[model samples]
Target: MKSKIGIIIGREFNERVRKKSFIITTLLTPLLMLGLLVAPMLLSTYSGDEQKKIAVVDDSNIIGAHLQSTDEINFIETELPIEIARKEHLEEFAILHIGKDIMSNPSDIRLYTNSTASITMEMNIATQVKMVIENIKLQQQDIENLPAIIASIQTEVNMQSFANDTSEDSGDKANSSIVATVIAYLLSFILYMFILLYGSMVMQSVIEEKNSRVLEVMVSSVRPMEMMMGKILGVASVALLQIAIWLVIILGAGYFIIPELIPDEVAMAVAMLQQGASPETLNTDTDMSLLQAIATLTDVGYLAKIVVSLVVFMTGGFLLYAALFAAVGSAVDTPQDAQQLQTPITIPIILSLFVMLSVINDPGSDLAFWFSMIPLTSPIVMMARIPYDIPTWEILVSLGILVATFIATAWAAGKIYRTGILMHGSKPSFKELWKWLRFK
Candidate 1:
């Protein structure tokens, strides 16, 4: 029985890996994901380099001079009226007017642009105006050594955090979140694609064997349970191989290419740090020691505990659903009939994704905890919650439920497959399926 299962699994794996579709999809998916990860950074850099010209119609020279020297802004003096500027499509020109109360109220300066200013441009203008006001006040007080006093007065706060009775830097939180989000997304998407890919492969294999009447010959050699297990294991092995290859590619890219290809924003942030700017000010805070943090979070001696837990849950989740798909395929005479049954299975996955998004906003919510505990939703939901730190007992309980579901579903699915594979030509109803399940 073991040897027969092994042979079947080997055949299934060989057939799937040799297919061109599997090869192409496996290679293309990671590259596409990498592109998506980097696209926003590339676009932002391109936009930042594009010069935006602005015209200053400063009735009082105070606001205009201050706005001119601000970063990333090229300000030009404009004597033209605001109405004329608008009529001429003057995005290249804008007006800055000091109201009649400028002497007593310098804040009464109005900026008139044909269009709204970019966020960076607006921030730069505000900063420059604030600096000018500070300088004016200092001069009014006849203060000397103002620059030294300002430099000395700027206080930097160093914040730290504690988790699991150990000190942790506050900077670790952002990095941890990113790592968790990336891992959760990767695991969830993999589960999703594999179930669709391998489950369809299982269904198609069953249909082809049934159509060619080869299943009858095979059944004489192997038990129905063995045949089903072999098919699932074989396809699963193929999926595992593809996943292994992807991991290798990702790890290689992270070590070899990612540093070189770091986005300009990230690079600029690093440069700022080299020049003594605080990480909070520059906003490039991905420098957390993820390896250390993961170790701390698990409190387990090995990383394999979390890894094994994820694999077990995912495998159970995949097989549980795959068995249903196989049963559906067996009961149907054609692919069209199989597709109709797919909607019910698909709805849970779609709902799981929506729930995962909600987890990002509120990981500690009761909704998240309950969703992660339910076997049907647990695989994806629990994987998402891992990054946010779930209790060890919860993980164990979820895994236990998932494994039990897989066993029960596989047994029931085998019953359906055994009857449906040999008896075809009509779609089976729920009542007929129950009858098939009871058949000796």
Candidate 2:
């Protein structure tokens, strides 16, 4: 029986992995995800690269001298009438209008744009005007140390957090907690995407086999349970293989590819992040410690715990859902039928995803505790909590429950698959399914 299942597994794995669609999708998915992560940074960096000209209608000219040009926005003094400046051929994004009585009432100053400008554009204008106004007000008040006082206004705070779990582990808790939280959310999200994707793959594979009229011949050679498990294991293996490839590529890019593309300072920061350097260690005077905070997140024990838990949950959830989806595919003749039956099977996962998202905010909450214990939701909810201070006993209990649940679920699904895989003339009603489960 083991040999038969292994042969079936090998056959299924090879058949699917060799397909052009599978190969292309497997290789390209990581690049697409990398693009998603990198595209935003690139856009923000070059978003305002094309400098926008601002028409300065400074009648009083008190603020015109202080106005300056930045890489994002450039101010140009315009003697043209307000109406004429509005139609300036220089492609100005906005006009900074200063009334003749601007100093007594700064409210008379206004910024006009062709259309409603972005909040970012408005804020840039406000910042420049505020600086000029401050200097003017300071000059009128005869303040000598204005520059010194203004520099000290936005004081930097070097805040550090410590974990209260154990006194012996008392260093800065800032690094571990933050890094763990990020890993927990990201891993759980990845699990969710994989389960949804490959779970449906298992179901579709079964349906395609049945629809082609080869399910009967296949059944004659292998037991329905063996066939079902083999299919699940094949798809599961494929999913894991793709994930491993993506992880390697992404990690390699972060370490090697990205550094070469970015500036020296950014490359240095990325290197620091990879090496686990804390921000406080880099510069005492500067509060830029976010990269160094990631250093403590590389705790060997913490990473091992997450990896072990991730593998278990990913396996448990896939096995549990794969069986259910196989049954769904067997009961229906078409993709439409399979999707109709999928609503019940998908509800728990959907509900868990939404609830777990909220649980991520407060992993120690009562809702999170109970949800993490429920086998259906545990893979997602428990993962969200793994980054926080979860007890070992709780994780053990959850795994035990999930294992038991998957066994029961697979057995029930096997019964359904055994009957539905061969029954195909018409759609089976809910009553017929109940009888199939009771068949001896």
Candidate 3:
């Protein structure tokens, strides 16, 4: 019996793996994901290379001297009326008009642009003007170097967090909430995608075979139970293979390529973070938040735990859903017919995704814990909680429940599959499905 199932599994596996679609998708998906991550950074860097020149008509003459130039924008002072500046300096991006009474009537200041202005550009100009107005107000009071006093007292707070689960010595190393949140979001999403995509693949495959009458020939020799298990396992092997390939690509880039690609300032910032340095101690030019995130992701032990948890949950989740999908496939003659039956199965999966969003915010919440305990939702909800370094006992209980649920679900689905695989012509109603479950 096992040999027969193995043969069927081999046939199904080879058939799909040999397809051009499989090979193309396996190779291109990583590149597409990479593009999504890199595109924003590239656009931010080069999209505004040309500096926007603003013709400043400082009627008060107080604002222009304080106005500064950034790489993306320049403030050019022009000795002309606001109207003249707008008309004559058509080549400039905008005309900034400042009223003489601007100290009291701040609304008198305006910007006339040749075209629509971006929020960022408008905010920049408004900020500069607002600062000048404040300084003027301060000078009117005749205080002793008030501007320098304010600048000297400027301060920002950076709070370092450590997990209570760590040892006393390990408490010195701060944990990043941002890293945990990002990892949780990504893992949950990946688990959701894997379950939905692979589970549907099993359904579609069953539908195609049943419609083509290929299953009629194959099931004559192999038992329906064996065929069902064989098909589920076959497709599962393919999914695992694709995931392994993706992991290799991702880990290789994270460990070997990405570190080399990051700027030296980023590395220095990460090093400072490890040594318990405050945000103020790191180079102001470096993006400390991004560097800290990268450093946490590249941790060998942490990454390994996340990957293992994902694979375990992914396998259990897919199998549990895939069996139900196969049963739905066997009952229906077409994809349209399967839709009504699949709704109940799909709702839990969809609900889990929505719940995952909330889980990232509070992994220890009662809602997260209960949802993670429920087998139908645990795969996604638990993966989200895993990155937060939740208790190991909770994970073990979730995994045990998931395994038991999969076994029970597969057995129940097997009964439906064996009966539904042979029945045809008419769609089965709830009553008819109940009868099939009771069949000897």
Candidate 4:
């Protein structure tokens, strides 16, 4: 019996793994993720290089001199009238018109452009004019060195945060909640997608085989329960393999790329700390939050724990949901027919994703704890809390519940699949399915 199940598992596994779509997807997914990460930075770097010139027809006359050129914009003062400047400087990006309100009415300023201007461009013109007017008013008050006084008093504060608890290694170090949230969100979303993607794959495969009468041939020599388990486990192995490959590629790239991002002085400061130098001896301006974020991600122990938890939860979650999907597929003759039956199974998965957002903000909240404990929602909710260093006992309990739930679900699904796999030409109601479950 075991050998027969193993054959089905091997056959299902090899059939998908050998497909060109699988091979292409496995190779391209990491590259696509890398592109998503790097594209914004590259665009920001090159987007501001070309400056747009604006012809200034400042009726107030004093404001034009204060207008400065930035990487994205250039202000050129024009002696021509506003109407003439609009026509003559049509080649320019825009014409800035500052009213001769001479002392008040800041609303009189306007920007006329040859073409439609971006909000950024309009904001830039308004900001420069406003600053110039304010400075002029301050100077007219006859205060001594007012500009210098304001400049001297200008200050900026960058706050650093640290966790209160000192028991764990992460507790003593500075923490970046932004970085933690991003990581948590990414992990949870990936887990959610994996379960849905692979679970649906199992359903679709079952439906396709049933439609083609392939399952009829196989069931002659195999039990429905064995066939269902074999297909679920087979697709699970394929999902895990794909994830393993993605982790290797992403981690390998991060290892090489992260060091290049660190400045030489910062790298030296990190080395100094490792060599027994005190934190005070290093550069005071070093961004501790960024450093800590980098250190947290690269920590071998933390990474291993996360990876292990991901595999465990992903497997358990996929199995719990896939069994229902397989059972639904077996009961229906077509893909459209299966949709109506799959709604009950899909609701928990969708609800879990929405609840994960709140869990990220307050991982220790009662809402998070309860959701993470429930087997149906635990996989995503628990992963969101893991990055915050939740208690180990909670994780163990959650895993235990998830495992027990999967076993019970698979058992129930097996009963349904046994009868439904042979049924044809009719759709089963909820009452009918319940009767099939009790078939002696």
User: Highest lDDT: which candidate?
Assistant: 3
TM-scores for all candidates? 0.74, 0.85, 0.90, 0.90
lDDT by residue for model 2 (1-440), tens: 44478888898889888999989988898878778987999998898688888889988878887888888889889899777887773467788898887778868888888666889888887888888887788778977787788798967675545445564433334445566667777888988887888999999988899989778998988899999998999888887777777766766565566446555664465456445445545533323445434444434455567767877888888888888899888899988877668888899888888877888888888999999999988888888888775887998899899989999988988999999999887888778887888898
TM accuracy, model 2: 0.85
Backbone clashes per model, in order? 0, 5, 0, 0
Cα deviation of 93, candidate 4, in Å: 2.0
lDDT of 4: 0.85
CA shift of 378, model 4, Å: 2.1
C-alpha displacement of 59 in model 3, angstroms? 2.9
RMSD, one per candidate, in order: 6.6, 3.8, 3.0, 2.7
1 or 4, which is superior by lDDT?
4
Which ten contiguous residues of candidate 1 have the minimum total lDDT? 293-302
lDDT of 1: 0.70
From the highest lDDT down, the ranking of the candidates is 3, 4, 2, 1
Pick by lDDT: 3 or 4, better one? 3
lDDT by residue (tens digit), candidate 4, 249-279: 8889888987898888877765554343445
RMSD of candidate 1 to true structure, Å: 6.6
Query: Which residue pairs come into collision in candidate 1?
Result: none
> Which residue ranges in model 3 land beyond 4 Å of their true spot?
166-173, 261-291
